[model samples]
Target: MPEAGEVAARVAERLGTMRGAPVSVESARQLPAGASRATYAATLVDAAGVPEPIIIRAVPAAEDDGGLGAEAEVLRAAADAGVPVPEILDVGLGDDSVLGFPYLAMNFIGGESIPRRILRDDTYAAARGRFVEQCGGILARVHRIDATQTPGLDELVDPVEALHALFPREFDAMPAGLVLATQWLVANPPPSSPGSCVVHGDFRLGNLLVDADGVAAVLDWELVHIGDPVEDLGWLCAKAWRFGGATPVAGMGERASLLDAYAEVAGWRPTEEALRWWELYATVKWGLICAVQANRHLDGIERSVELAAIGRRSAEQEFDALLDLGVVSPEVVPDPLGVEATVPDEEPHGSPSSFELLDALAGFLRSDSVTAEMSPQVRFHTRVAGNVVDVVRRQVLLGATHAAESAQRLAALGVADQRALCDALRSGELDGTDEKVRAAIAADVRARLLVANPKYFAVPHP
Candidate 1:
């Protein structure tokens, strides 16, 4: 809640013991990556003629009731266990005299986030392998520490419960098809064979501060919990976290290596089936989160274009999961024909610009909806509708329209309608083989991508 400048000033003051004299904030820049917490990099000058640079990470005052205290405790425990992490210089409840919110000051980690380059380039071919090793290695140590030893971290939710909690309350408002999918998932919960360990609730490449050698510090503990070790693995390799399309897992390492490294150090190798279940659960959980964020935008609590865009992608992942789960037939996917023709080559006919169109879409996304007075659940999806409309608008503007075109084309090609497609999967319409569903979803996604962004979809013969 504190202004960035104020938080930086407080951090400078807190570090006075380390450097001596009244510390003053020399500079501050907001670190822009997370959804839940606010972070800042602060440069401090201590009158003792010493230069001190510390990162000030603060949980908003609203979340301060227990999150920050819990994080500080977990970081302390991890540090004590020799897990690589920023040195915690000071932890505070924060006052008007200091920062406007509860804050923690840590030694500023120096290095580009490994994910900044590794996920996008081949220069870091070994980066993925090494990243996974460090994760498994450090987490192995984190698991070794007794949960009781970590102050204020007692009542942590298990992975299964956590997964269910992650679903958007608004999801109940989705079409009957999605509602049915939800019921199926709830009825068939992932197995909860319990284990005892401290789970890094959001451990993944992005959450880590890393460099060429390895992980500098495993950051972000707002979601830390005392639960099964595999929960961390499940979260780490969630497809949603894999910024890249599909090749690498979790935007870092190979899926097998991630498990292998953990098994090598932890002395317990997880079956691929077990990991698959968690991975699927991860997708569902993240899907719910996206849905929730979109709901926030819809409700006008937060209006972010990126959130709206990414939120719609959740269902794509869910459909992919159904394919993975063997509930749907693969190759029987509907073909694309009529759908591609409906999309205009260029809407608004190239006057202002693509950025202008996106800005217009953002504005439209924030406009008050006719369903503004609806129930909370309905309101959530009305928000989603606004976002989806913008996406269609963007696809129209950017010449990469994907989904609807594919659906129409599939229907034209003598494929069943949407209702039949859902029923076929639900009623064992195809031979009861999982591969069929997987193939079907893959084909549909490829077509949708083509419609969504044909420019990106276009390829020339070498």
Candidate 2:
């Protein structure tokens, strides 16, 4: 994370270049919960003494590239195409005389990005009704942006091949339900579409800024690419983006309504088969992404409680994949806890038990850190830390038994470990539909959720 002083200095320097005079940064602060890049909202006074509110999107110094320039170009193209997007002001700064990292500045638009607020808040009820159709229309316009018009965005490839490359080493070792879905995807590839277009690689509810008027602007263009357009549509409907709402289209609009809106604008609707294929792919892709986020924390690249907590969410995606694949029924099974095992209290003279210490830490984070007046980033991470501790507490209570049961099931299926089983399944050596294989995979997924997040199972699945 860049220091507030550094970010302010960089923004001021960049503003000077654009305004042809020295600029003063009045305030700069990091936004909360940015997963990939550091985002800052700043107020600047130009040479003319005109105050401007801008958002600075920058990558860490160690990972800086000229990608911001390309992103600015994409944003311009999107605006020209009639898509709702933030206005790009400047790009490609971070020289020795300016900011220390490559960054893009854009005019910040006021709106809400939280899914729950957009979906449930009475103030946004009218916006919610129009969201699916509006999003569909916006996406159609985005896809119509000719690839040739934008430079440096020609890097396009098969979506399936792209997904295959995202499997991290950790995923291979654990072989969660994603292994089964990936195998099926490889065997049953979707019919290739004939052309490519600009895709909002991360189009979904949270990425959209909304108000009473509906979506004001689409944000997060870091993953923008030229690919199958349906990729965006499918990602929009992914269960991970739903935020606990039952509606499939971003937890607000029905799938059919979204498709109908898209068809009216794009002149064609994606087939049911095509949508299902991509939706399943989205699930697997999110699972792999969760694994990668976790690995970043584990490997010490960027230690964050948020990243660690997201790692546990990979199992939720895996469970969703199983439901989509029909390998597991959508019907909820009874909780794995048949009878609670008694956890012994600390010995008379022993140190505090592991659970006791973890519970205390979790309570402090929840009760103190959250209510403490702090920066949004600090408060968000504090809550995430509390959640992490709670997950660890569950693991402490249930992990050993879950592991023992998983090991026994794997042995009965003639696999020495999860890695071997994944290899067999991926290689088509094992019957994916075999009762034993499905049972073992389902059982493992359930046990994982029981620790990682039990609320996931409580949500109705279709």
Candidate 3:
């Protein structure tokens, strides 16, 4: 990865050559939230002395454009169709000399993409007020885009099956809740909308740029493909994307309003069953993605506490899938992670037990005095590291209890373990729709979430 100054220099060189004048790098900063590419927001000044702001998306030389070249073409088509998207300035898809890799540069649009701020901040009251309608209208436009305008749109074939295949590949022992969702999904596949259209493979809060007025630009076009457009709408409605908001539509608005807005623009509305099916699919897909991220840490590829913490969050998606499947138990589990359960008087791990030490560390990391001067990124990671410690602490306190209970549930189901339970569900040897099967799976998921994210239990769901 190149440093900030190197990115600025490269941006200056590329723009200078294109503008036929000398250009100077004014500034460059790394932007958060891109998983696959290193993204830099940069400023450059030409001989004319006007500052130009742009975003550079790049991959290593070894990956060579990493499908970013295709994304640029999608942006151009989307822009032509009246969708608010970044204006592409230059692309080094076929050429890499500028940055020693494939790159895409675009004129940057300033906006907030953070879900918490976009949903809660008074600064974005107007955007929050109109998010559903605006996002629906934007999605309707996104779906209506011509696939012929971009050649590779058809490459992502049958996303539903691809997701089904990906989940098993990521985990040695699949969550029982997800197993039920998979069984249900495979048994009741939703019929795709009549004609194929351009689907923004990921269209949700984090990917949508918002200003006070409303959504400013639809970002992250890398997932563009030819598929059922309802996938975009359904993905937006997934509870995982809601980020604990009062409403389900990106946690900012209602689904009815979104459908009304989309119908007004697209001249059609997806059936409730189709929307439900796609939303369930989206949940399963996200769980699989969580597994992938967690595996990256466990496999020694990234070695991040954040990644390890994210792996634990797969339970969040698992629980959400069960919620969508209507098999979640009405009984709520108490928040287990935040509780300060103490060690025995005869401390086995010696003075200041592991759990007690973690409690102290978590407290210090969260102290305003400690975090007050830290940068936002550092503070965020510090918080994550604190959570990672908390997870370990909770595991130490509750791991055996949870494990015994999980094993007991599995035994009641005539399965030896999670892998056996998941295998039985997948092979249809065990009835996923059975009340006992559903209840056992739900209990296991609740236990996982209780340890991984007890606060997640507070999030309201249907």
Q: For each candidate, give its TM-score against the true structure.
A: 0.71, 0.93, 0.93
Write the residue-wise lDDT of candidate 1 on 155-187 in tens digits. 435444454454536444332224334444555
> CA shift at 402, candidate 2, in angstroms?
1.1
lDDT of 2 by residue, 142-167 (tens): 89986776766744475656765545
Instruction: Identify the runs in model 3 with alpha carbons over 4 angstroms from their true place.
Output: 61-64, 94-97, 154-157, 165-168, 171-173, 329-333, 337-340, 344-348
Each prediction's Cα lDDT score?
A: 0.61, 0.80, 0.80
Model 3, span 1-462: residue lDDT tens: 578679779868877888889989888887754444678888888788889888888875334567787788899999988899999988886655487787888898999988888888999998788888888899889987878889865544666566655455674455777777777777787866767788888899888889989999998887677788888988999988898876778887777888889989999877778887888888878887888877877887666667677878888888888877777633455666544565535445587877778889999999999999986666777889898888887787888888999888889889998888888887877898899988888888887887888878767775
Sort by TM-score, best first. Answer: 3, 2, 1
**Least accurate 10 contiguous residues by lDDT in model 3:** 338-347
Q: Could you tell me the TM-score of candidate 2?
A: 0.93
RMSD of each: 8.9, 2.5, 2.2
In terms of lDDT, which candidate is stronger, 1 or 3?
3
